[model samples]
Target: MPLRNPCALLPRRLQVVASLTLAVLLFILLLGSHPTSTSSTDYIHRVPYGPAIQSSAHQLVENLPQIPHDLPHVNTPAWLNPFRGPAHTPPPEQANSSSGEARWYTDFKWRNPFSSDTTLDEERAVLPPLAERARVYTYFESTSKDDKTKKIELELLQVWRRAWWAQGFKPIVLGKPEAMNNPLYRAVQGLELEDAMEKEMMRWLAWGNMGTGILSNWLAVPMAAKDDTLLEFLRRGEFPSLTWYKGLESGMFVGSRGEIEKAVKEAIAFPAINTTKSMFEAVGKETFAVEADHGAIAFYSSATITAKYPLLATKLSSPSTAVQGLALLPQLINSHLHTTWQNTFSSGIAVLKPLPAHTTTLIQPALDIARNLSQCPSTPIPASCPPNKPRCKPCVSNNMLISVPPVLRNTSSLFTIATVPHPYTLTSLLHSRLDLGVKFVRRETDRDSWTVAATKELLGTGLSSFSRLPALKDFVAGSYGEARTLWLVAEEPVRGDSELDLDALDWHFGFQLPRSPVSDGKSVTPVPGPERRPPPPKEEFGEGPPLSEQELMTERSMFMQAQMILRDSATGSAKGKTRGGSKSFAQTREVVEAWNLADTEVWRFVRAWDARRQLERRGWEEEEEGFLGKGTFGRWIDKIT
Candidate 1:
């Protein structure tokens, strides 16, 4: 017997209704199984089902019956509470009181769940005494006869001394007079200046035998005083007898005095030329005619010594073998600095795009001027410039020259190109003509090398200027433009003043009044004013008292609230859309405005608290001034008395 159709059993109207209901159920199941892609705006606006389910489960758990207070509890094993050992039992008087209920969760107490149980006092006990700390020696040889250069070197030495002293390390400065006493120094006195400097450091290290010490150059500034890995290595005495920076041995040296002395003596006795040739042969390169410095000689000698005595020397790049190494004390190479500056200048110009027609027209002429300046003859022409005059040369390589094109001199447009001294003057002139209302504020320095003082001044000025400009702040906070203008100025100069080998001519531009605003054959140059010294280092090093626990907690809570506000605003933007079915830009603007207001209020509160703290600290300082005087030495004197 064949089965009849299911629809034959029902009435005609009921059969049609049953077929429609089955089709609707099938559609619902398919729709739920495969979700369609949604726009970002829709995705943000979608309801969160995860939190809803979590809340429902939490409610169910809360409705369930809890364990009775009178139920017998099992004691947890001591091994389970490894952080704090076994749980403590309540006293006899409090055992039967209401506090007994609190003891039910006593097994969960953790002194420090994240770290070992070793106390800070135990760590401090193993630290070496101040006198026993490793000594770091830096050699300062003033090759430049410029008084300004010497003054800068002295200032750097003072900074270095303070940095090392703060970290409980002894820093010693070596000079020409100290090196003259070493017999090894006298043997290698006839070498070239750079080679001689290296040999001098080696001789001093060998002769001094100053226990565990480091040999470093003056150019290597201390970025941080405290390195836990370095400190632990020193504390445990786990390093080999002689340890140097991994890639380059000359950058830094750290070792015990005895091993370093032996290594230095062997390096000094080795023939420099033969060492260079051997190194070239080892690398499968032909021996080229180049002067062998102390670095090469030392590397060769150390390799030879290590072959016989494996434990005498080692090279380290990181704290452990498993971790990658980073340069802690980077040697500032001139070529590297020039490349970095070029990249920065190009990238900065690249971000300002879709330039005005007027700005775009001036770029080619500027490039021509740059090319002309770069190709100018080495000698000064009397026809182009008169003798005994500052403007004798068509172009000068020094940083002092601020060249302005003849066209924009009288345009009534405010254009300032703040940049380092590049080989091309046209780059700065073009930057000024961009009409961005930007004040390019570059710190002027006397030295050829980049200085910390210059960096601080530049950063401070930029930050202060940014804080005052709402447009700049918005540009930084929002994504607005793409970087595509770099190719436009790719033909510009790639070298700076430091990379040039020519002597800088003392040239200044003579600006004549009643000059035509149009492009003329004559270029306008404004003489830079007298040099200004950077602010004192004390402000950079000085730190105020740390934030109180309450202040810290407030900051954490505010940060969390700010994060939540940002997240909610992102999702709520779709809800605040107009009738056009688009996310409202007005809503975004309102959110940003609200955030700025909240930020202003928060800053005001912080400033008020800081002012109050300063006042309190001042009062305490004034009270102590009577006995401590003004300096740290005075406080020590008072203590001694």
Candidate 2:
């Protein structure tokens, strides 16, 4: 208070001047140690703090604006961050290792889904050596002490070995006299019996290197007729036309070694390949490169050829013996035309006749054979009778003559149950005559009108569920008493036929696929201390080599002759005098040659068709049951939501 009195005493104008001089002095004192800059005043004017301080003390609050707490909106990508540009970038080593491009990009080394080394090894270990590659597993359980049963088993084994030999594979029988007493043997036999055959089939296809396997019971003998053993049929250059389940007998599979390995690899990598419901479904989706099991003998046999030789896969349509039958007359005509007119026949060959829709008309050829065999007028009474029967019976042809149409249903309906003389057996004979085209129709239907093919197809609806599935449920659900009985009888070979009597017996078959055709990297013919042949000289690039006109003509003639032979042999003729049987010649040589040429393609087509047909039947049944609209909950959800 005392010092303030001196300034108050001075004049007002002098006081103001004195105050300004003091302020300048104070600013100079504070800035004395720092470097002087003209830009300081401009910097102070640009800052918000400087402007607020310059305002009157009471008005400072009004000049300054409030700071914002909310974040600013941004739409820019992370890479385009302005604040963290090149100058603020961190070293890659210090940045996130698991993020960005490194994490998102795929490595080429681990691309295959099936590339599990451990899994591959385990699967490979299950396969036997090359010497034992193609194995056909079968079981027989008989609980009787009869000579007939013993003879049947012996005959069956002989036929099985013959069929296996024809297919170029070794047969290993898995049954014994004491097979019924051992629990372990029974378990193995049961697995072969109860498992759905398709699993082993796929396994064989994947692992079998050009190996064919059959997993069937003792009843599944390979014979042209019941009485004709497999060996006899092969000797005569014939295959059985009538088989259990038609084309699909019991567990049968065929494929090349390379394809089976490839398929297995693909299946391991992509599980869906073996998980499809039907073979055709797999084909439709191309899930697997190999063919599917169609449960038909024709399909299995034909597809084996296609699998071995890739060229025939797409060369034919409806590659079945049935279609081949209709081409017989036309092929014969073409052969005659070629032999007569030579060059003129090339421009116009005869078209094949359409297959008759009526079952009776198609079966006529087969029926004629039966008639001729039954009427052996020259033989004595007992010798003239059909083999294996006790007495002579009236000829089927004579009985059918009374009916106007001579149809199976009308002609056989008159016979009582006891006097029928097993008419059903004749069906196979007819089937053989028709090139295995006959379809068996069962009684009991709701509809009144239908074509023969359509009727048979309709009857087949829901059949796979009952037939294709393994009998596992029946075995598992069986009581302890029955299980004990099975155990007790495991090694004991009772004289019971699995085919006819199944009350106390059960069996199953299993097979493994082989890795290679030749075993242990060894040649079929061993070399003498690695002696090698010299390499052939290479030819020039231009047009290869020259051929004479005579050589070219010879090749063409031979090719045409081969084609004729195939058509002639695909379906055999009855070779009976008069028009009684088919008027065609039974050319066994042609049959064998044609089979060798076309067996693969035929098997491929039939098997694929079997899958397609089975699928179709299932769909048709589902539609009839109203399951298509109501059963699928996914569709309901889609419709509602």
CA lDDT of each candidate?
A: 0.32, 0.28
* All candidates: TM-score: 0.25, 0.17
**CA deviation > 4 Å runs, candidate 1:** 1-131, 186-211, 224-227, 234-239, 273-641
Residues 446-514, candidate 1, lDDT per residue (tens digit)? Answer: 211111122233234344321332322212211120011111121122211221211111000000111
RMSD of each: 25.1, 34.8
**Which window of 10 residues has the lowest lDDT sum in candidate 1?**
503-512
Superposed by TM-score, candidate 2 places the C-alpha of residue 607 at a distance from the truth, in angstroms, of 44
Residue 362, candidate 1: C-alpha displacement in angstroms: 60
Clashes of each: 0, 42
Candidate 1's TM-score reads 0.25
Error of 1 at 167 (Å): 3.0
